[model samples]
Target: MKRSLDGFPKIEVNTQRKEGKALKKEFFRKERDLLGEEAIPENAYWGVHSKRARDNFPFSKKVPPSLVKAYFAVKWACARANLEVGLLEAKIGNAILKACEEGMEGKFNEEVIVPIFQGGAGTSLNMNINEIIANRALEILGYSKGNYQKINPFDHVNLSQSTNDTFMTAVKVATLWQLDELEKEIINLQETLQQKEKEFASVLKVGRTELQDAVPITLGMEFGAFAEAIARDRWRLWKSRERIKEVNLGGTAVGTGLNAHPEYIARAIVHLNEITGLPLAKAMNLFENTQNLDVFSEVSGLLRSLAVNLRKIANDLRLLSMGPRAGISEISLPALQEGSSIMPGKVNPVMCEYIEGIAIDVMGKDQAIAFSCSSGQLELNHLGPFIAAHILEMIEELKLGINAFTEKCLRGIRANQERCNELLEKSFALATCIVPYLGHERTSELVQECLREGKNFRDFLIEQKIFSEEELKNILNPLEISRPGIPGFGKVEVKRP
Candidate 1:
């Protein structure tokens, strides 16, 4: 008998390629289950059940590592609860605890080769973890792989748990973890927007309604609006966290707690909160938690809102930075790459485009999450993993997308101050500002005259002496006109010539 350098008895799964050919021979240990026997790699920590799952799930890709670690966390909590209730033997439970601790650190994540998409409602995933922890615990106790006789996967590591409850619990826990990260990203972007607002606070530009100029505005105020939108999203996400913290653990196999001990079920939330360091709570009604997935759908709805806001913000930036020579080039984004292969001196708002694309992708995934949540059957939602996949994917996409958008675009954006002043000067939209001073009838007459003569409203106002230079400056101040309350309304009558 031989042992590997890692100190486990030699049960190695290896392949050697010789002269462009696959391995000619290999070795494995035989493991048996209710489905009969199967050969597994002798040194591989995962046993027959994991092997069967990986074989069955040919199309399964990588499960999110967050979900994987969260699963480990759930199991660790369960083991703790089981030990407290006298359901798990101290010697064997301590070994399982060590194994679970390693798994939480991502030590055994790669060994979980089961595919994510399958018909078992994440049973394969649960069993895969169980097998890994069991075998690793066996090695810790001076045993070889496939030594389930020393520490059985289902009997010992998985005491007082069921796939129905544990997997869904892990999903909620994992989503919460990712949500925390996403909230930080949103706050980061929101802070950047606030910085831009302060930076461009005094910048004057033409404000538009329905894509047509309506009035004057400060560029800082527009960024402030973006910040406000993100703030709302952040609030919604924070509120949504409370809903998902109520997990369905201890509701074994349909909320009946059939095989789970009463003490374990009673103490489940306490252990989970201790392990995850979050304010996790047990479900108020385990049965309702077991079958109903409306909570997840609601969270997905918020994600949909976030995506919409991001897309809207990106589009606004794209339009503001649309043209350098002939377009509404009121702002300039940092150039990160070649804009065109054929046109020289050409640049595009690719960062804005990228953010918009991610938003749309998030929206599509949000729909998938909704569909998956609503598809649950009587006593279980077989689509927990499915919903988890889409939600986790959206969180990751938004995080990276928001980071890229802020770093590559928002932070580097420069206000085209000269261009903004030029557009504001050229546009007659400022004509709306003088209504109170000139009265409606007189203001319209002057506006038509300026249009007929092809003159700017500011120029015409100055040329016609509609107000004294002091009064005109006061009436047409971009900050004064853009703010709330009537501009030049409460003041004494303007000095008109």
Candidate 2:
């Protein structure tokens, strides 16, 4: 033994002493009894999650922070629900609340690096939080760690609760929060598109390839379509909110509400509503809620549909803004970063590409959710953990998609007026609009003459003297012809030559 400069005792061991080996032996003996019990091994620590889960589900990356946040939200709600329902004493509720407040303030999330995939149906996750909360509460009560003497993880901290109920409740509460974020971002994107529509209302484009001055369409209509699509998604999200409200909070162990008081169920829901300020309601059938994850599946389906719609929009935007020189340049996307390494002037739709990737990720998560939901067996749904994990992931990705689309894509997108005008001027598709006014037979003759002579519609009309320049101009005006009040063949007086 030696003393350091600070006077603390230090034992300097030679190789012969084997001090490390002696310490390891002592520690192993102490931990042996703890490891004997299978339900909760005594030697377990907070950060040590199951490695097998990580190996099994390599498809999903580590669980997202949003999912962890949702976990906390659900725990808080559960504690509040327990208090409101009188499942726990007021003292225990107060202690749990104080512990939760502390837990929320602390860096407890550092322990959630474990794989979300587990054969125990999230029992490990439930225990992980339970142990953490119990330890924190013990500290709050001035008790030593691992002392079941003061606040037990099961009897006190997790009284009248089961992993089945708590996990599902957490999923709903977390999803509601995530959906709120998504709604705000989507609405912002919608508003941005609407403003663009109004700004470009009068900008017109004609059919260009046909070299026919086809009927006119304002840039506003294009942007307006984008706005309408997002608006519909917003409504769908709003409508789906109520479905998440039906939580199975009291269905402990398995939807039987066993070991729980009837009062506890009602109080839990009421308190949860108060704590979250959300309109959460008790499930009409706890058994169904636990056994059938159809609701989660349904919501996941809606999310899939949303992702598909988002991808479609992104694809259209990318196509419309394909090139400044070569492709169909109907719009100019906001150039965020350099698009190409070799092509000097190339500016790819990076935002759209990002959104497309997000959409793909969301779709993949949706499949995971569906698979997890389907894997549930009798009495209790074992896939609860995976469901929560994937759904939360979907929400986060969608949020990023909405934000990126708004900031990088929608904000930077501009109507390529010159390109649009050129394309419209060249397109012969406008021939259809004029056919309704010129009579089908005459329109056919005009189209044949233009095609045979490789001449423009205006040039051919002028050479044939089909009508005076003034009449041809009036008939070919895209804006007037495309308008609602435009006269048809019966209304317009035409002299047949």
Best by lDDT: 1
lDDT of 1: 0.86
In candidate 2, stretches whose alpha carbon ends up further than 4 angstroms from where it belongs are 1-61, 80-92, 206-216, 467-492, 495-497
Clashing pairs in 1: 11-42, 11-43, 12-43
| 1-497 per-residue lDDT for model 1 (tens digits) | 45544444433455775757666455677788999988788768888888888888788778899999999999989998998889888988888889999999999888989877867789989999999889888888878777676789888988878999999899888889999999889999999999999999888899999999888889999999999999999999999999899988998899888888888987877888888888998888898999998898899899889999999999999999988888999999999998999999898899899999999998998888888888998998888778878888888899889989988999999999999999998986667777666677777888789889998778777787666667656666666766786666655374333
The total number of steric clashes, by the backbone 3 Å criterion, in model 2 comes to 16
Model 1, position 25, has a per-residue lDDT of: 50
Model 2: per-residue Cα lDDT over 250-319, one tens digit each: 8898888898777777777776776667889888888888778777787888888888878888987887
Evaluate all candidate structures by whole-model CA lDDT and list the values in order.
0.86, 0.70
TM-score of model 1 relative to the true fold? 0.94
Scored against the true structure, residue 88 in model 1 reaches a CA lDDT of 85
